[model samples]
Target chain A: MKRSERLVDMTKYLMERPHTLISLPFFAQRYGAAKSSISEDLAILKHTLAGNQDGILETVAGAAGGVRYIPYLGKEHAENYLEDLAVRVQDPKRILPGNFVYLSDILGNPQDLRQIGKLIATRYAYAKVDTVMTIETKGIALAQAVARYLNVPFVTARKRSKVTEGATVSVNYISSSLDRVSKMELPTRALPKGSNVLIVDDFMKGGGTLTGMQELVHEFEGSITGICVLCEADFDKEKLVSDYLSLIKIDQINQQEKVISSKPGNFLTETDFSRF
Target chain B: MKRSERLVDMTKYLMERPHTLISLPFFAQRYGAAKSSISEDLAILKHTLAGNQDGILETVAGAAGGVRYIPYLGKEHAENYLEDLAVRVQDPKRILPGNFVYLSDILGNPQDLRQIGKLIATRYAYAKVDTVMTIETKGIALAQAVARYLNVPFVTARKRSKVTEGATVSVNYISSSLDRVSKMELPTRALPKGSNVLIVDDFMKGGGTLTGMQELVHEFEGSITGICVLCEADFDKEKLVSDYLSLIKIDQINQQEKVISSKPGNFLTETDFSRF
Candidate 1:
């Protein structure tokens, strides 16, 4: 293939498989080009991605050297997205009964998920996350998105046991929002032993569900590398878990007054965007 | 930017926002290049994607015209993937109690989800699907994957009502697997009226859950564009629903014998790959 054609195909291939290394010989054989030419094409790809501040192409040097695409977004991009997300969360129409803010629409949106996933993956690009874990229903999407960017598998925990999944390990945690004890379970074979897990969720009220997931990870002998959520109820009761990250923090949600207020969470300040 | 850099950036940009039209003027302004140069750059991208039969760059004419990227795979590509998926499904260890096969690993895999999502999107690329719908738990990942490729929002139907989602529309259908009437609900604001929804699920036995989703679509005053599933049990009893596409068909699973059999479904014969 010609250089221009190779560049287009190469960019699409690398973007699809982020955090994966592709050896020079493999690209050379695929494009029927010389190793030196493949290196030059990669140089162009690296420079363009860096110039755009949307992704990073890391070149590993050694006998096992190759190129790895890291989904790294610039600070400006992350800040602008969080600002827009916070504004969107502040819509009065989203106020629900009992001070709950309706965010299902945002959670279901693909563009928003892509941005959110990219932002979260940027934070843990170097954290060595073996797998992304989330609970049933809402958190699955976020988990899948982050897993895609990180090039890893994701596992979901279920609240109710089902016969389809075979054997499962159950964990009980306080349902802080409901003021009751609830149980969540994960399939025995879903996760491997000693895996590094990154927990994610759509909404966190008292961090009960997050706690449940953490316990499940422990049961599997996996370590919790990080915890993140799309939205956190900052004004609610005390949280069970600290040291977690959130994209948006809801300060107030007046149901009768039909008002809501929110701001970007600590994810912005906690994340280091200087790599771009 | 040079032609090589422009090609790389343009390919990445278009791939990120599938099914969304981007006019030449927009690309010209973003790259600070002439309109003719932008057109040439897109031409290179279109040709490269076509050569690989991986994607389709469609051009619109006249005013309000631009280019849209359709995630498409050739017939051979789809066939090869499904064949490999069937072989993977044939693993004897996946056989579980009650003749059920464990597939959470495949469902949770990002790479497998990407291929499944792209194949399904190819089938519905021109179907004008307004939204993707699936039941809670297992189907959420498949729904999100397809929705992302189609650039549409996905809605999940919960098995039980939750206070977090506010008001919901409930539907009752016979659970073929359990042989009991079960209820599923979707938030009132989750889906809009008059949408063309594509229902998807992770597994189908009697297809009772799919029927419930179909009924829910009707209840919302929307149309059912199509139904797709990742796996279906062929040796099971009569199905409650037909006219659906499945990626893999499990013919039999004997837990005691440690045997499982499967093959590609009708999706391959149903899809037309000539567009590439």
Candidate 2:
């Protein structure tokens, strides 16, 4: 293939498989080009990605050296997206009963998920996250998005036991929103032992669910690398878990008055945006 | 920027926002290039993608016209992937109690999810899928994957009502495994009326869950575009839904003997992969 054609195809191939290394010889063979030419093509890809400040093409030097695409967003892009997301979260229509803010729309959005995924992956790009973990239903999307960007698998913990999952390890945590003890479980083989897990969720009330996931990681003999949520109910009761990050923070939600207020969370300030 | 750099950035940009139109002027301004130069760059992308038969750079005419990147895979690529997937699914270790096969590992895998998502998206690329729908727990990942490729939001139908979702519309379907009727519900605002929804799931024993999703879609006054599943239990009893596609077909799963067998499903034959 010509250099132009190779560049286009190479860019697409690398972007799809983030954090995966592709040897120069493999690209040379695929494009039927010389190794030196393949190196030149990669140089162009690396320079362009760095110029855009949203991605990086890391070159590994050694016998098994290759290029790895790292999905990341600049500080300006992260700040703008989270600020806009916070504003969108403030819509009065999203206020549900009992101070719960409806966020299914945002959780379901693909564009938002992509941005959120890149942001979270950026934080843990070098944290050695073996897998992303989240509770069933709502948190699955966030977990999958981050897992995709990090090029890792994600496991979901179920709220109820099902027959299809074979055997499971259950954990009980306080459901602060419902004010009751709730149980969550993960399949016995879903997560491997000693895996570095990054726990994520769609929403956090008092960090009860986060604690549940943290406990589940402990049960699996895995270490908790980090904890993150799409939204944290900052105005709610005291939190049970600390040392976490959130994309947005809900400060208030008036059900009777049909009003909601939020702003970007600690994720913005906590994240090291100096890399890009 | 040079044409090489422009091509790299443009490819990454278009791939990130599939099915969304980007006008020529927008690319021109972003790259600080002429409209004609932007057109040439897109033409190069279109030609390369067409040659690979894995993507399409569709151009629209007139004042509102632009370009769209449709994520697709060739017939050969689909066949190879499904065949390999079938081999992976036939592992004896995956056989569980009650003749169930353990596939949480594959479902949780990001690479497998990407291929499955692209293949399903290829099938329904032009089907006018307004939204993707799936039941809670296992199917959420598949739903999210397909939704991401189609650039559409996905809604998960919960087995039980949650306070966060507010009002919901419920439906009942037979739980073939349990031989009992079960209820599933989606929030009233989860899916808009008259949407063309594509239902997806991780596994289909008797397709009872799929039927429930179909009923939910109908309850919302939306049309069923199609139904797809990652695996279909062919050795089980009669299927509840006939018009569906599956990537892998499980022919047998003898729990006591610890043997499992599977092969590619009708999805390969059913898909019209003639469009490159």
Candidate 3:
């Protein structure tokens, strides 16, 4: 293939499999081009990605090393995405009957999920996460998104038992929203013991659900690498867990006044983005 | 930017926003290049995508015209993926005591989900789907995968009610394994009326759960665009619904005898890949 054609295919191939090592010989064989040409094509890709500040292509020095693509967004890109996301979360029309914010729109949005996932993945790009964990229903999307970027499998904990799962390990935590004890469970074989796990959820109300996930992680003998939530309800009385990060914090939800206030949470400051 | 750089950015931009239309002039202005240059860049991208048969750079003419990136996979890609998937699923260790297949690995694997999602998305790329729907538990992963590629929000129907979702629409489904009627529900606002929804599941034993999803779609006055499953148990009883696609089919599984057989299902044959 010509250099231009090889560059097009090489860019697409690397982007699809981020953080994966690819050898020049493999690309040469795939493109039927010389290793020198393949190397040159990669240099162009690396320069293009670096110039855009949207991605990174790292070159490895040895026979086993060639190039690795990292799906990254520069500081400006991250800030712009969070600011727009916070604004969208602040829409008053999202307020539901019992003061619940209707965030299904954001949760379902592909672009939003992509940024959120990449942001979280960027935070843990070096964490060496074995698995991503989240509770059922709402947290599934956030968990799956982060897991995708990290190239790891995400395990979901369910509140109820299903025969389909075969066997499960259950954990109980205080449900502050309902003022009762709630139980969540994970399939027995979902996570290998002693593996590193990153916990994620859509909303953190008093952090009760997060604690449940923590307990479940402990049961599996896996240590919690980190915990993050898309939204945190600051107006709620008392939190069940700390040392967690939120992308957006909802400080006030005054249904009577039809008001809501939010901003990008501590995720930015909490994240160690100095890896690159 | 030169055509080389423009081609790289255009590929990334179009791939990131699948199924969305982008005008040629928009790119022309973004690159500070002439319309003719932008057109050449798009042609390169379209040709690259077409040659691989991995995606389609759809061009629409007239006043509302530009290009759309459609996620697609070739027959060989689908066959190779599903064949390997079937072999993995046939592992005796994956066979649970109650004839259940341990699919947690597949559900958690990002690589597998990406391929599966892209393949299913290709089938319905032109179907104008408004949403993707699935039942709780394993089906969540499949639904999210397809939804991610389709660039649509996926709604999960819970087997039981949770306090988070406030109000819901419930439907009755025959629990084939339990041989009893069971109920499933989705949030009242999860699906808007008149949506064209594609239903997906992790496994289909008797297609009972899919029927329930169809019923919920009916209650909302929405239409079922299509139905698909990751695995279908051909050895099981006749299905409750027809017109569904399965990525893999388990023809036999006798735990006591320690035997299993499977292959890719009818999806490859039934899907219309004429667009590429």
Candidate 4:
């Protein structure tokens, strides 16, 4: 293949499989090009991605050296996205009953999911995240998006057990929003012991569900590398978990007044975008 | 930017926003190049994607002209993937109690989701699929995967409604597996009226859940563009719905003998790969 053709295919291939190592010989054989030629093609790809600040191509030097694509966003890009997302969240029409903000539309949008996923994946890019864990329903999309970029499996915890999943390990935690105990379970085989897990959710109200997931990870003898939520109810009464990051923080949602206010969460300050 | 850098960024940009058009002038402006140069870069990308049979770059002519990337797979690639997937499904260890196969691992896998998403998107690439819908829990990941490829929003039909979602429209269907009438719902604001929806799910026994989703779509005054499932139990009782495609068909699952048998479904034969 010609250099131009090889560059197009290489960019698509690496973007599809982020955080995966692809040896020079593999590319050389795929394109039927010399090793030196392949190296030059990769240099172009790496440079272009770095210039765009949306992706990264890492060159590992050694006997097993290869190029790995990392789904990352520059600090400026992250800030702009969060700012726009926060503004969108400020729509008063999104206010739901009991001070809950309706965010299912944003959660369901592919473009929004892509940006959110990349942002979360960028934060945990260097962390030892063997598996991405989330509770059932809304959190599944966020978890899958992050896992796709991280090149890892994501497991969902269900509030109710299903026979299809076989054996499961259950955990109970306070449902702070409702002020009641709720149980969640993960399939016994879904996650392996001693794995490093990154917990994610769509919303955090007092961090009850987050705590439940944390305990479930412990049940499998796994360590919690990080906790992240798409939105956090900052005005909610005391949180159950503190070591967590949120992309958007909802400071107020006045159902009676039909008003909502939010801003970019601590994720902006907590994340180090200097990895490149 | 040089031609090489333009090609790299153009490929990445088009791949990120599948099914969305990018005008020549847009690329020309982004890369600080001439319109003719942008067209040449897109041509290289289109040819490479076609040769590989993994993606399609549709070029529009005259005024309002641009290029659109379509996530597609060749017949051979789809066949090989399904065959390999069927063989993997035959593992006796995957058989759970009550003859249910454990497929959470596959659903949780990023690589598997990408292949599955692309395959399903390839089938509906030409259809007017305005939205992708799936029942909650296991299907969210699959729904999001397909939605990402199709550049459409996906809405989940919940077994139970939540206050955060606002109003909902509920439907009742016979749960053939449980042999009981079950209810499912979708938030009123989740899907708009008169949408072209493509329904997807992780598994299908008698396809009760799919039927429920079909009804929910109808309630929204929308049309069903297509229905696709990742796996179907061929040995199960008569299906509730007939117009659907499955990637894998499980012919048998003997819990006592710990034996399972499966094969690729009608997807290969049903899909037309000559669109290119």
lDDT of each: 0.92, 0.92, 0.85, 0.92
Docking class of 3: medium
Q: Count of backbone clashes for each model?
A: 0, 0, 0, 0
Q: Which residue pairs collide in model 2, if any?
A: none
lDDT of 1 by residue, B112-201 (tens): 989999999999999979999999888888999999999999999999878778889999999888899999999998899999999999
Which digits, one per residue and each the tens of the lDDT, describe model 3 over residues A70-132? Answer: 877666677788888888888776676655787876777777888999888888877778999
Q: What is candidate 1's lDDT per residue for A55-81, written digit by digit as tens?
A: 999999987999999999999999999
What is the Cα-based lDDT of residue A56 in candidate 1? 97
Comparing 1 with 3 on TM-score, the higher-scoring candidate is 1
Regions of model 1 farther than 4 Å from truth: none
Deviation in angstroms for B186 in model 4?
Answer: 0.6
Model 2, range B94-161, lDDT digits (tens) per residue?
88777778888888888999999999999999898999999988888899999999999999998877
**TM-score, per-candidate, Cα-based:** 0.99, 0.98, 0.96, 0.99
For every prediction, compared with the true complex, DockQ reads 0.82, 0.82, 0.57, 0.88
Please give the range of 10 consecutive residues that has the lowest summed lDDT in model 3 chain A: A267-276
Which stretches of candidate 2 lie above 4 Å from their native place? none
Better of 3 and 4 by DockQ: 4
